[model samples]
Target chain A: MRELEERIKNDGQVLGEDVLKVDNFLNHQVDPQLMYHMGEEFHRLFQDKKITKILTVESSGIAPAVMAGLIFQVPVVFARKHKSLTLKNDLYTAKVYSFTKKVSNEISISKKFLSSDDHVLIIDDFLANGQAVQGLMEIIDAADATLEGVGIVIEKTFQKGRQLLDENGVEVQSLARIKAFENGQVVFVDEDQD
Target chain B: MRELEERIKNDGQVLGEDVLKVDNFLNHQVDPQLMYHMGEEFHRLFQDKKITKILTVESSGIAPAVMAGLIFQVPVVFARKHKSLTLKNDLYTAKVYSFTKKVSNEISISKKFLSSDDHVLIIDDFLANGQAVQGLMEIIDAADATLEGVGIVIEKTFQKGRQLLDENGVEVQSLARIKAFENGQVVFVDEDQD
Candidate 1:
């Protein structure tokens, strides 16, 4: 977690007050070494929980989720943004609003992948408005599964994403927590959270 | 390699004559244990190459690429299907045609990630017509970088993907090579390729 926080401080770009760009390591251009370390940390944090599966959305979350799944040696189920021909017909779908994209999109997971006995751990790159997290939780709920926790690589706490998940009674763990941005400088939360 | 071929034969679905669905373990729901083994196999295949980076497109291709990157202890730069706030301004972009989606979408990678000095290994989940791999090769060409080879989890040799990559003189190593479907059964090509 310290490595991630340090990387964010050194490489992350602050676009005004609302956006923090971490393409150098987290999202677009990934640092696989750092990514695996973060995944190991997530596994260490959630080792006590009975996690049968790992859940995440497409694009950004897949890498970290894959790493987490590898560490836990569990199956990972990602909700597709669209109906691809490769996916089966039976699915559990949920509607999610993207605060970053400014578009409401539907995300779904094949019903065959998830079921009533699963204890799921949701992972993603960024947690802003927490809409994606809510959507994943809905899919898990639809499968009659238990939500173990949510693991995020980077979290923007100023956006109140954590508050929303907290109100929903979801335990969230983030590698790097951004308290806020001031005059293009990033302000990170306490290191103890890591 | 035999394990991967076995997984494909067991879990992979043949949809009519056009699509092969391996969502049970490859795309929709990922088996991290098998995925890590596949990554290890890629590591063994490309062990001689001096790869400084692992490159692939976002979403499905991301998992295997990340796994391979972890194996090499190098950076993994995934091309973005849709630009996010995390992406930087300086980028190397290429147009990719998706046969499944039947659309031409552009994938971009930040210029800061890949350099002419870096040797890249392109990795992907499925290779049908090689459009995604072709587009990634174009990105490598645009950056004036060196391409070590390509590592694919599964390759449908019955399609034109291998032919296209062969024509381009790009070395491709696929874990499982599907020759054809005979009466709803999957037939693999010569095992010598593995």
Candidate 2:
């Protein structure tokens, strides 16, 4: 987590007020070494949760989820953002609004993938309004699967995402928690404060 | 490669004459163990290419690309299919026609990630018509970066993907090569015959 925070300070670009662009190393262009370390940390955090599958949404979240899946030795299932021709008809679907993109898209997972016997851990790159995670949780709930916990690479604590997940009784863990973006600079939550 | 071929034969679904769905293990619901092995095989094939970075498109390609990035000890850069709020304005863009989706999308990569000094290895889930890989090659060309080669998990020989890359003098390596799909059964190209 310290490494991630330091990397964010070194390379992360903050545009305007709410957008923290970590495309240099976190999302678009990824540091696989750092990704492996994040996976190890997540595995250490949730090793005892009996997680049978790791779930995430398409695009940015796939890197971390796949890395975590490798470390956890579990199957990784990603919900598609669009209804592709390859995707099956029988799916568990949910609608998610992206505050960053200012759009809502339907995310879905094949019904054959998730079942009541599976335990799911949702992973993602950034957690802002918590819409994406909530959508993923809905799929898990629809499948009657057990929600083990959520692992986030970077979280914006100033937003209501944490509170929303907390209200839903979903256990959440994030490597880097941003307190605020002061003057286009990141202010991380101090360890002692937590 | 043999292991990959076996897995495809066992789990892959032939939906018609064109679509061969391997989403069960390669895309939607992924087997991390198998993914790691595929990465290892790719590493073995491109070990001497001096690849400085691994490049691919978003969504399904991220899983194998990230896995190979881990083994190769390099950064992985994925082209964003859509222009998002997080993506920067300074980008190398290309238009690609998706044979699957029947739509043309602009894929872009931030100019900051790739450079002339970098040697890139492009990886993808499936190579049908090679449009996606061609789009990625355009980005690499725009940056004046060196493309070492392209690694594909599955290549449909019945299609013109291999011939397209070959005509461009681009080196390609595929784990499994499908000769044809007859009566919902996949027939792989005999390597010894080649």
Candidate 3:
């Protein structure tokens, strides 16, 4: 977590009041070693839980989720943002509104992949408004699967996302928690404060 | 390679004459151990290429690309299919046509990540029509980066993708090469023939 926080401070770009762009390392251009470490951290965080499967959204979440899947020795299923031509049967779908893009996209997973017997841990890159996590939770509810926990690479603590997840009583772990952005710099939440 | 071939024959679904659905492991529901092995295989195949960066498209490609990045100890950059709000500057763009989905997506990569000095290896989940790889190659060309080779998890030898790469004089290494799908069975390209 210290490594991730340091990486964010060194490489993360602060655009405006709330936007923290980690395209340099975490999202667009990925640091696989960092991802691997995050995976190990997630595994350590949720090793006590009975996690049968790891779920995440497509694109950004796949790397960390896959790495976590490797550490956990479980299968990772990523919800497709765009419905492909072949993906048209027994799907568990949920609508996720992206505050940044200002668009509502339907995220879906094959029903064949998830069921009541599976305990799911959701992994994602950024946890901002918690819309994506909520959508995945909805899909998990639809499949009658148990939501084990949520693992995030970078979390904006000042945002409503963490509060929302806390209200839902969902166990959450994030490597880097941003307190705010000031003068084009990222201010991380102190360890004691967390 | 034999392990990958066996996995394809067992879990891979033959939807039609050409479509081989590997959503169980390689794409949607990913097995990270398998991905790790594939990454090791790719490293073994292209270790001498002096790869500085690994390139791939988002979503499905992230898993394998990150795994290979970890093995090779390099950075992995994924081309963004959908441009987010913050991604507005110094961009290299390419249009990719998805034959299966019957759609064209403009993929972009930031100028900050790639450069002429970097040697790139493109990794992907599947190689069929080679549109995605071609699109990535275009971006690499725009940046004046050197493309060392391509590493594919699964390649349909009958498809035009392999031939296209061959014609372009690009080195390609596919872990599992399928000759054809006959009666819902995957027939791999013989090792001797390859």
Off by over 4 Å in 2: A83-89, A191-194, B83-89, B191-194
Better of 1 and 2 by DockQ: 2
What is the per-residue lDDT of model 3 for residues A1-194, given as tens digits with 9 covering 90 to 100?
89988888888888878898889887799999989999999999999999999999988899889999999999999999853345556888888998998888889999999999999999999999999999999999988999999999999998899999999999999888888888998888885564
Q: Give the winner by DockQ.
A: 3
Worst 10 residues of 1 chain B by lDDT: B80-89
lDDT, candidate 3, B11-37, per-residue tens: 989998899998999778999999999
RMSD of each: 3.0, 2.5, 2.4
Q: Residue A67 CA error for candidate 3 (Å)? A: 1.0
Candidate 3 TM-score, C-alpha based:
0.95
Per-prediction DockQ scores?
A: 0.81, 0.84, 0.89
Candidate 2 docking quality: incorrect, acceptable, medium or high = high
Question: What local distance difference test score does each model get?
Answer: 0.86, 0.91, 0.91
Candidate 1 stretches with Cα past 4 Å from truth are: A83-89, A191-194, B82-89, B191-194
Give model 3's docking category.
high
Please give the lDDT score at residue A106 for candidate 1: 85
> Model 3, stretches more than 4 Å misplaced?
A83-89, A191-194, B83-89, B191-194
TM of each candidate vs. truth: 0.93, 0.95, 0.95
- Give the alpha carbon lDDT tens digit for every residue of A61-112 in model 1: 8888988998998999888886334444687888888777778888988888
Candidate 1 at A117: error in angstroms?
A: 0.8
| Candidate 1 C-alpha error for residue A137, in Å | 1.3
